[model samples]
Target: MRRLALVAALALSANAYPAQAQAVAETADPYIWLEDIYSPRAMAWVEAENARSLAVLKADPQFAGFYADALKIAEATDRIAMPRQIGGQIANLWQDGTHVHGLWRITSPAEYEKAEPAWQTLLDLDALSAAEKANWVWAGADCEPTAERRCLVALSDGGEDANIQREFDLATRSFVSGGFTLPKSKQWVSWETPDSLIAARDWGAGTMTASGYPFVVKRVKRGAPLEAASEVFRGKPDDVFVIPRTFTDGAGHSEVVIMRGITFFEAEFVRVTPQGTTPIAVPRKSTVTGLTQGRLIFQVNEDWTPAGGQPISAGSLVAVDPAGKAAPEVIFAPGPRQSVDADEVAVTQGHVLAAVYDNVRGRAMRFTRTASGWQQSVLPLPDNAAISMVSSDRASNTAYVSVQSYLLPTALWKVDAAAGTAIQIKQTPARFAADGLVTEQFMATSKDGTKVPYFITHRADMPLTGTTPTLMTAYGGFQISYTPAYSGVTGKLWLERGGAYVVANIRGGGEFGPAWHEAGLKTKRQVIYDDFAAVAEDLMARKITSPQKLGIYGGSNGGLLMGVELIQRPELFGAVSIQIPLLDMLRYEKLSAGASWVGEYGTMANPDEKAFWLKTSPYSNLKPGAPYPETLIWTTTKDDRVGPVQARKFAARMKEYGLPYLYYESTAGGHGAGANLKEKAMTIALEMVYFQRRLMDTK
Candidate 1:
């Protein structure tokens, strides 16, 4: 019945849009019923749609092979056990053939460094899920500070962002009876101590914000009911979210902080003490990276002028003794084309390791406190690669850094902060034959004359032709940097099968820090779309790939990019893969978590922003008879981030207007589209198959 309903809706929607691109009317929409997520009727429609999509895609000749190889790659036992330091022991969450849902296990550092570590499982998600008949997904644990053993374990059902946190003992390796337990809701929690906690979650009624996140924080003591917990801090319902975060420095100094996320990139940090909440006098664009030596260390993303001191640069790392009366001191500052990597800071005992990028190349520095003041020295590391901090702790000067490039498999390095020395710990075994793969950087001139950098990975001997089947992707939003990293699945499934890949580092990202992102924010967002289209056009101009063989893919914000480009520049692409996207820009604010992103994407309530969205919104501008590539639109029913409704509405609208599009939605996996390894592998296979059919295989 649901399938027939969709078919009927498609027939009506085939001509849903106006002849000219114009502001869409709410009255024209015919598939708002699909927005009822998880209702039996809506789910029935989803199941029928999934069945139809599976029947078609699974019958493709490449489907079986892609699935087999992806499953093998996912289930491979030899993959590195990325170690997480906990309680002076190495912990890891692993999933393979033996353990499908994954096993949170622990081992010693010495044992972990060995080829095959004897791992002791602390929690088996698969077994627990089976026993309870619930789809239990591990969200991670926040442990006690002193012992770092007793923890508050977070578990989500069906992979929702909202989850239930329960306390567990690491010594006994079991959930303690009558332990600290918070009922399921989107929350922020931290251990005030073993006997008490600081948290913000849905208490009863009107506790969550308009965006479905907690706005009030409370102190819940052991053995006390949630309602009896005293309110510590409260935020307005319109704010993004309020979080209670506990930061512990190397010298046994700890600070309880309340982070009020006013916008996506803007936040306010306040110190919570016995007296009350005191606001920290830092720029709203600054982040408290880590604490060290009783000094609050953070990276400033906006030009900040203290009460009386001169201004600090936008991309400078600064340290301040918040408890003292000393002025803020800039620790490190990057020059013209340099920016600190967003996720590259790690705090070790008495030291902070930072990775900075210049012209898309990586460099590291170690900052240590001295008698006079804090000082920094360069740490030896390879350039022209993406480097990340895998694991680090405040207990010791031991940290792990993983480095990789487009062609290079990731290699882990253990860095000693005291000596500023690093040693190779492990290198991933190459999953595919890469005798002569070339990685080259190129720049495309955007419409606004901004130079956008991109990476191309292809066979070294391949000719400069306009017919290579190239898959291009980009994500240009939210100050997130897109760096070079090795992907086993991409190599084994796509590259080995004679496909070239390109990654475009456009504006609205932290590629060159705050300034680069600022240029593409809100009202100036068209430059980001223009940057992506310019890269695609540049690829064709360089004879790398032409429209006949070019495919593009992106998820989340990237998916929105795909949508905009699909409508605005349809002739440039042969295939489009949009996963978990936002399409209905006019009504986006009312969608799940849409109101929270108003800073990144301007609210439609404003006249100028509404006009801008009306002119360029993919959903609003999708008119009938427009030339568009055969597109694949996939999402998950459990996705609470962008939600699955957007995808459903877009597909239904496309069908209404008789456009070429494919739609599929998984029942679980939340925002990512899968819960277990097999589920993820299948989605990958399906996506690759779609690309192969459009760009590689002769139809």
Candidate 2:
């Protein structure tokens, strides 16, 4: 047997604290070697861990059956082809057993409305990967404004965040030889002129932030070398990232803006013109959505007390004049209980469409600019459904919107923004039987007398015996609302097996708008954890489930939440699944893309913040004698967004302390667990098998 702490070494960094206290608080983690992602020694350790975990989990009698079910569901041909209207054509990215990597295809709107649309493939990723002997995943494409024929296509290797950009011709349906090509890097590129593009990438050392992101923006001419690109703007090394923004309106008016991201939630927008660059009057914590009728529009993430203007509340959608450089005009103000969950501002030939959420429920509105001000007309949509404006073009008045609920598969609606008319265009076939399943919402009281809402999905006839196998999850950060979402995988794999699913809408989410998230910011984040614990306890109190049969899961920020719960309330859950999470919060500032999130999570530079971190950092808190539930922790080698190093260190620390944990790290797949559908299915199957063993078989 391998001695868990044999390779461990601890290091202490004094950050404005007594040397003794700092020494006691910090340890040179032996697992720091794991941070060298592709190092042979680290990779060998990862391979051994993967094999050991797979041997046990895959040996289960239900493994093959679960894999088959998951693969079939994932490759189902009847699944909806989510469409986007571009250049008067309906385009979609599709994948199946035959097209594993996916096919970027297009069709006419008329044919797309048919039962089975005739799709013409524009790019076949699997074929390209096979030809190049490389794993290629589609990042996205930015087509030229007027013709929409030439596009800058971004492709990532193994689904990593770093991508290579190339110019492609839509007419020829092939990459444009001798056209624009940007070498592989984590970069942002926007269309400038027919022969120039505004870009920001690693221009060697000192060109990137501490988080490994580009901090310098430049103009790259058609055939010039990256070094030859003219400098457009440059941000400090401590700045999060810097990039150029190009806003083109329905009226064919175009504006270039320089965005210097001072932090994750703050930025400075300078409107670029032929004469020079002019600073726009906008709050630090605001995001520019698009330009409508030659006016710049943005959503405020923080309350704006403009130099000479009255206070504008956070979460308000405001518009400003780039020409006049005047005070922003509040286009739409969210109510005390409302937020723009899916902030959709699509400028059509004549009008703008906005989708707003009130208490986690969705609604769409039409905003028409008048001489007096902006007027709103709420579009007709079903209550309690999540609405998303998937596709719209400046040339057309019709926009594609999708509405879905927990039980209802997505239904595509073609909305005429000018007329405010929404007509159902298409829908997805039911992937699982929903006849007996029912969904209902409930509220649990938090520690601070706050009401936290949650949804329960299970059989209507479920007995309240406190023995039901339950899977509970939530993502309570980033102000992202947890609205009703349809998941056929859960329906078929868990619910059909007599399991229950619960989603908590707790603090630190946009469920109740900005106020909800503000309640749990930084050091005050304990309330967010308390809200989740409250919901779990509420379920137990209602006799819906007991600790023996309950499992919790989450990914990314939610993965952090799962790690916290595993340490704080181990007795409340039978199993915990943490995926692509930030576990070692202390050294997170030094990891890939971690510095950008300091605005959300307080930094350790402050003595008080360091104290909070010393107490809460999951990896550091793993004591040798504490009892921890058997946990499933997984991440991807290509996950540059959050870095798999944190997960690796956590698992290694758990091993050092002899805690029970199953770790799996894929060689590829970026921020997402997998680059292809098969990989996703395999991971899902493994998770299901683990949950079944802990929550169902044991029960």
Candidate 3:
């Protein structure tokens, strides 16, 4: 067993913090050695912990059945091949039992509309991995703007975010000899031209940010080595990642824009030209989605009033020309109850398609810059479902969208933005039985009297006996909205087994736009946790389920929520699954990519923020004899984004306190767990088994 405390004090530099606070925080933490991710002691401990936990969980009578079912669903060839319009073809990365790594394939738009599209394999990752004797994962491919023949293909080793970019030719179906090949590193790259590349990675010493990301952008010619690359732009080392993106419109108009991330939610954008880089006027909390008709289309998250200009409210889509010839136009300003889905916004040849959540439900709108002004019209699609833009083509007014509800499988819709017409093209075959299941939305008032909405899916005839085994989850951070989507695994594994599931749209999320998220930032985050706990209590109040029958799970930021809930509201849940969590708030900034999130979670260097963590940090709050539920804590060794150190230290501290817990860390799989389909299936199956044992098994 590991010791509870170490001998040496944790030294925080005087420059980084106040002397007194640094001295106070220097007190020994037992598992600091776990921070050395590949150290011998850490690996040994992980091995033993995995063996111990797997022995019990895999011994469950239903584990094999659960694993088989999950695997079947994961590797099913009938699964929908999600398509993206690229280079005049519909491209998709498909994985099955045979193609574990995946097969990057492409088909024509006409053939893709059919039930069984004729796909030609562009890259066989499995064969490539086998030949190279390396575990390669397909990241993505970026094609040149005009010709769309030469492309930069990114491949990750194992599943880490850091990858190598190799220039490949679509015409020859092979990698270009002596072409642009960037070594493996956490980087961002875009084509400056057919002969030159603009990139940001680990250029050399003093080039990386504190967040383990590249802050320097450089331009490399076709035959130049990385060392010979010339500096194009330089951001501060304290800043987050810097990216140079090129946007092209239908009229052969192309613009290269460089973004220097001041923080996670803030940035400075500049248009790069042969003359010089010029500042693109936009709010700090705004993103330039694309360039359409020489106009930069962007969405602002904060209300802005320009100098001698009209005030634009928060959550508004607007466009501005780089030439400053035309005044800024408000494409779409969301209503009070409407919030734009940032990930769903796309620019096509003749229109800008954006998906917005209206009162937590989805609606798609098309914005076109007409002679009069910007005209907005709602796209004709299924309502009461989560609608999202899948892909859009800049060469044509063709796009694809997806719609899915809690009970409805996902369906693909092809839209003609020019004609304002949409048709359902393809849909996923139902993986599980949903005939008897129903979904309903409910609202629960938080401790501060703020109403939070949540959705529950269960049998229509469920009795109000408060005995149903229920599992609830929520991600209440990062300005991300948790919308309704069909989950075949949850429906087939849990719902089919007489269990109910809940999704709480609590505070600290973008459900109602920036205001809703900013309402729970920093010390005000207690309300987000309160909203989740309130939803659990509301379920009990409605006789849906009791405390002993309730389980909750989340990953990444959501994992942090689970940790807080396990400490703050232990009696409300039977099991808590914290996956790839950030537990040690005091030291989170020192971990991988953690410093980038200071915009969302405040830094400990601030006196008030330090005080808040002292009270709310889960690792610091765990006691010897708390009535805590046995937690399923899991993370990946290759999770370079959040890093596994936080999870490891938290679990080690739990052990020191003699608390009930289970820890499993996979050797691969990066931020999102499981390197391959089988691994992912096993992880899901393990969760199902653990939930069944903790929440459903009545003695």
lDDT of each: 0.85, 0.84, 0.88
Q: Candidates 1 and 3: which is better by lDDT? A: 3
Q: Which sections of candidate 3 miss by over 4 Å?
A: 1-26
Clashes of each: 5, 6, 0
Q: Candidate 2, TM-score vs. the true structure?
A: 0.95
Q: In candidate 1, how many Å is residue 197 off?
A: 0.8
Model 1, span 555-667: residue lDDT tens: 99989989888877777788999989988888888888898899899998898887677767777777675657778999998888789998888887888788888889988
TM-score of each: 0.96, 0.95, 0.96
lDDT value, residue 446 of candidate 2: 90
Least well predicted 10-residue stretch by lDDT in candidate 2: 7-16
